[model samples]
Target: MPQLKGIKILLVDDEPNILRFLEIGLQNEGFEVLTAQDGLSAITLVKQFQPHIVILDVMMPGMDGFEICRMLKKTENLAVIMLTAKEEVEDRVKGLNLGADDYMVKPFSFDELLARIHARIRNHFPNMWGEVVAGPFRIDDRRKEISYEDKVLELSPTEYELLKFMAINNGLVLSKAMILDKVWGYDFNGEENIVEVYIRSLREKLNDREHRLIRTLRGSGYRIDVQ
Candidate 1:
């Protein structure tokens, strides 16, 4: 089987043993892994590693995993998974609503994690390049490419994924709260800074003055519509 290489992961938990085990497991699967013990540290690591995926524990001192998941979703370019102990409909709902690509209960199989990760990766960037055109911006899903007025825009992998998510769900009044839940990961609790940061970063790259395809709906999240 051809290997899936270069997937960077950030594992956040207060338990050192769990962190070590997960890191080893992910590394064994050929993924680069980073770990954090708390929410603040997780955020910093998130900024530094800019991980492709995050496995966050929902319970922690100071800032819990849910809180962290909430923050990361709002970030410019990040994806997350809830590796938590909460196993209830409400917990699942909470995590999914936060932007978690996937969620798993504790003692989950490493194989399961690997599988979910692979699936999401493939889903986000397929081989078909299913094109999504909104105004001047065109998204080629297969190659994970986006362009404005035929000018190719440089986008980070996370940025491309975020844009694609919004483009697919265009016209819906997605909340900043929900975008954080759906696009980022479920482990996030309630921070909104990450989402805003990424939006700003995306605007800078998209040159909002010219394109401004991403719109900020008052009292709502954001939207992309052709004017």
Candidate 2:
């Protein structure tokens, strides 16, 4: 099962290998990730993307991580975790003073970094932590599973993404265009009827033949009415 939370994270590092490695790891763990090799681009992406957390590397050309973190914390309501090769106490203190929520040295375990990211999310954005429960459905992002009425649903990758998106926006009327852009990438050149096909599949699996839980709004689109 793929992790389903749409948590956005920004990874800033000047090293291509480091960026590629972390990007693949985090994406596998179900995070929406964006990367920047320089501080200026990092700042720009932060304003544009508004990620929930930032993984910052301290040593870089132009503007360093410390200065970037300082600028970010002043205007952004997000967590910052600093990474550095140096193990000096002064550097750690400086990062913390500049509003970094956590610190990790280079060569750190990926598991440890994942744990710290969860910790920071829990500490800083407590409301967004853990499973998403709405009506009879429970979406466990960490486990990448969704259960209906305490029974886990066997869902394909696309089904999982589509259902999770609907569950997140449960009472809102979601048009086909919006669903396609989100579930399938905006760059997906497929036909719009693809949304209808997936919706039918989800309805069948969900036993929503009567359209009580998943409703079709004539010309508008679809909605998940759990009540």
Best by TM-score: 2
- TM-score against truth, every candidate: 0.54, 0.60
Clashes of 2: 0
Where model 1 places Cα greater than 4 Å from the true spot, the runs are 125-227
Q: Could you give the C-alpha RMSD of every candidate to the true structure, in order shown?
A: 15.8, 15.2
Worst 10 residues of 2 by lDDT: 1-10
lDDT of 1 by residue, 171-221 (tens): 555687777777777788758877887788888987786545788878877
Candidate 1: residue 178 Cα off by (Å) = 33
Candidate 2, residue 129: Cα displacement in angstroms equals 1.6
Q: What is the C-alpha local distance difference test score of each model? A: 0.76, 0.89
lDDT of 1: 0.76
| Residue 73, candidate 2: C-alpha displacement in angstroms | 0.6
Residue range 58-177, candidate 2, lDDT tens digits: 999999999999999999999999999999999999999999999999989887787688777768875575586767889876777899989999999899989988986677789998
Candidate 1, after superposition: displacement of residue 11 in Å? Answer: 0.4
